[model samples]
Target chain A: MLSIRNLTADVDGKAILNGLDLEVKPGEVHAIMGPNGSGKSTLAHVLAGRDGYSVSGGEVEFEGQSLLDLEPEERAARGIFLAFQYPVELPGVNNAHFLKEALNAQRRARGESELDSVAFLKLIKEKIAQVSMQPELIKRPVNAGFSGGEKKRNEILQMAVFEPKLAILDETDSGLDIDALRTVSDGVNAIRSPERAIVLVTHYQRLLDYIEPDVVHVLAGGRIVRTGDKALAKELESKGYGWLTGRDEAA
Target chain B: MTTGEQRATDLEKVLRRGQQQLAAGSAADNWLSAVRERGASDVMTMARPDRKQEAWRYTPTSFLDKAEYAPVVEGPFGAIQPADVEELMLGDQQGTCLVFVNGYYAPALSRLAPGQHMPQVAVLSGQLGDVPAQLKAHLDGIAEHHHVFAALNSALMSDGALLYVPRSASVQAPIEILHVSVGLDEPGICHPRHLIVLEEGAQAQVIERYCALGEAVYFTNALVEIILRPGSRLSHERLQEESALAQHLSDLHVRLDEGSRYKHVSATLGGAWSRTDLRLNFAGEGAQADLDGLMLARDKQLNDVHLDIQHTAPGCISRESFKGILDGRGKVVFDGRILVAQDAQQTDASLSNHNLMLSRSAEVDTKPQLEIYADDVKCSHGTTVGELDHNMLFYLRSRGIPSARARQMLCQGFAEEILDRIENPALHGRATRLLTERLMTYSE
Candidate 1:
């Protein structure tokens, strides 16, 4: 479903994703794990087409179209979704209104008729229940004054609503308690289908227990060092990344 | 001559014209005549507002040099139709609308609700022959006439709306004062002075709206004085939407007695050059006042708001929040000051001014000042001038919304923070609609 070849990106003239390559197919889940400053988040951002990150050398193909040249909205219209690590707080933008506008925008871009308010409310209510988010939260401003767990759940709600072809979860498990982790995992697991691909970017193996991955890749020096199965996650958790990168565990 | 000297000369010419108009419409009442004479003399002697003065530093006075304004004595009231006034009426008003075209009361377009409990509503021009003692006492007394524009308004005051609520009467419907400035053949100016008085234990809501009819060079110098007696409450909303070729200047003075409450919302959405000077004075203890303002300036328009809040009695509280959205090369100035007298113990006051610049060239000068002379008082002031958050923009765009729509949504959100403060649903909806339409035209 997604392919990246020789993705060499820079942020402010400093290399982040250096010669990185990854591939994922439909109906599969991939886990990209790395230490701090290993370009895990940068990979997700680059895929989402965020500004200020100059892609010096990259050939990211989604389905069959080149993704590098598309704007963020264009990418979104093509069913690419990035669940932010830290969700932004829109002070005065209502969550439900924003979600409806976003859904309609994507629908309009695909030449589909937009959903009316009644239809949107019904759809959003069902999705909110799937993610176990309070219905009133959507009535308030988007993520404003929301708790950390609530923010993550809100992002999952958005992902469920969008139903993107490819979903990139960047550090979605961080700052979540055991209960929130299970809820988020359940939400993600429910949306797993043969036509959708999910990529989980994390720093720990805890999330893998709830939502098992088809493959795990260890990112070191901005490149994939190892690709293994679910058991590799446990092994790395027991033995820190020091063994994989030949550096101190604390570092 | 330098620019200042030229401006001074232009102001003198305008004042001289205003004096002649006042004499032509001479009133038999000596009190009003004396007031007009004093105001005219004050304008003659007072130094014309120049950049050298602190108050007029950011506000450009070159517009005054554009023409020697002809006082609007006899307006073409017949030119305005009922439908024209109907289009501008607020949805929630209780048909107590007084329409003024070119500073003259349009009786055909005006309506007063038939109710025994309704407040006394009259036109200033109609009552000038037999000026009521109560009206004369609070007309020029409420607002300080030291301001040059206020003095100018008093000097050439032609017509306005007067609202009087008796003691313990809670007015059910909002009183709507719609001031319509119709473009004439020459550069015209109108001074409409509004006086609203609420007796003890009275409650009322008033909406003062200023709208223009044509795209002509006109000036609207308006003054609204509000007096709240003990245990009284008033909610006032001022909406200024003038023509592109028009200049608007207004002064709003409010006096709060003991245990009174005042809520004010001012929205300046359209004008070439607009300035509003608002003052709130706490005369008795346990009074509270809340002020919220929103200004949108684009396409070289200049919008300025100066707020002065004084706490003279103990146990008084005041809160002020003002926001501005500027695009193009537009400029906005926010100067808010709060003062707590020495005897005003336990005063709680806070002021905040925030500006969002949509263009690189748009400018904002925000100054929030607090002068606390009381030993035991809580006072704070803050100001912020910033551009739209890029992260917020990115987050919106990443959700399939276009970049331009995302920016518009964000700017609307920034304005919604203040528009939400309008408790009246109809007025709030109108303001939101106007702002949304204005923000859509903004260039990315």
Candidate 2:
């Protein structure tokens, strides 16, 4: 469903992603694990087409189309979703209104009929329960004065509402307690289907415990150095990334 | 003579012609005659404001010189239908409406709640027996003597709405005053003086609306005087949506007694040139005042707002917030001044001015001044001028909203702080719609 080939990118003229390559097929769940400053978040941002990132070389393909050339909104319309680590706090903007606007925008771009307020409210209410968010929070401004857990759940609520084909979860478990972590993971697992591809970029292996991935990749120094199955996470958790890097050097 | 003096000579002709025209419409009433003549002489004494003056530095009054001014003739456009006045009404405020066309009251277009339940409402010139003493006492009290436009309004003012609430009267419904200007063969002018008084423990809400019926080259000089007694409360809203060729100038003077509350919202959406001067004085202790304004100027339109609040007594609180959205070479000028006297201890005052510039050529000038003689007082002022936040734009765009829709939402959000303060839901909705329509006309 998604492919990245030698993705050479820089932030502020400093190379962050150097000749990184990855590929994901339909209905597969992949986890990209790395230590701090290992370019995990940069890959998420680059895929989302965020500004201020200069791509020195390489290209990204999504469903056989060049994704790097599209704008952020175009990428979103084309079923590319990035659950941000830090959801922006938009003052004076109602959460429900924003979500509805986003949903309608995607619908219009896909040549589908837009949902009215009544229909949207019904749909969002069910999703609201799916993420276990308080209904009143939907009426308040987006993420303004929201708790850390609430903001993460709000992001998942948006993801569940949009129902993207390719969902990129970037550090979705950060700042979440154990109970919230379980709820969010269950919500993500419930939405998984044969037609969707999930890419989880995380620093720790704790999130993988709830929603087990079919493939595990360790990203070190801006490139994928190790690939294995679910057992690899447990092995890495016990032995640590230093063991992997030493073996890589020896090899 | 100095340039200031020379400019005054040329302005005097236009003001004098208006005074003569006003005199031709009125009867031989001693008190009314005396007030008009004194007003005319006051125009000569104050002359006209020039660029040299600090208050008029940013606003150029040269457009007044280019047009000849004549007083609107009486009964030339016949009577106005209530339907015509309804177009300018805010939402569904059907309580009481007083309509004035070309500075003359139209009884057919005006409505009042049946019977004694209605507060005392009358025209200034129609009834003289009970109005003379009150008019004489408060007419010249609020507006300063040096303002050239106020002086001109006082000189040539013919008729206006007068509302008085008795002691302990709590008016639930809002009273609306609509001033409509019709097309004229010559450039015309109207000076309407409004007087509102709330007695002790009284409460009331008033909306003053100014709009033009057709394409007219006219000038509307409006003066509003409000006196709130001890423990009284008043909410005053002024909405101006005049013709593109119209020029509007208004002076608002408010005096608050002990434990009184006064709130004002000024929304300026139209007019070629508009200026409103608001002066508030806290005469007794424990008074509260809030001044909020929102202005939209486009296509060479200019909106100027000047506000002055004086904390003369102890334990008074005052707040001033004004915002402007300028596009298409439009301009806005906001000058706010707060004064805390020595005897006025424990005073709290804050002033803020924010402007959003949609076009590179659009201009905004904001100046805030605070003078505190009391050692124990809290006063602060801030101003900001910038475009929409790029980060916010990207955030919205990332959610699949188009760039233009994102910018519009942010701009509307920036303005909602002031517009949301409108208590009437219908009025609030209408005003929001009007602001959006006005914004869509400007090329991004």
Q: Which ten residues in a row have the lowest lDDT in candidate 1 chain B?
A: B1-10
TM per prediction: 0.96, 0.92
lDDT of 1 at B30: 49
Cand. 2 TM to true fold: 0.92
lDDT of each: 0.87, 0.84
Residue B74, model 2: Cα distance from true site in angstroms: 3.1
- Tell me the tens digit of each residue's lDDT in model 2 across A82-192: 888888787767789899999999899988999999999999999999989899999988888999999999989999999988899999999899999998898889789
**By lDDT, who's the top model here?**
1
User: Highest DockQ, which number?
Assistant: 1
Candidate 2 regions with alpha-carbon error over 4 angstroms? A239-251, B1-10, B28-30, B84-86, B127-137
Worst 10 residues of 2 chain B by lDDT: B1-10
Question: Poorest 10 consecutive residues of model 1 chain A by lDDT?
Answer: A242-251
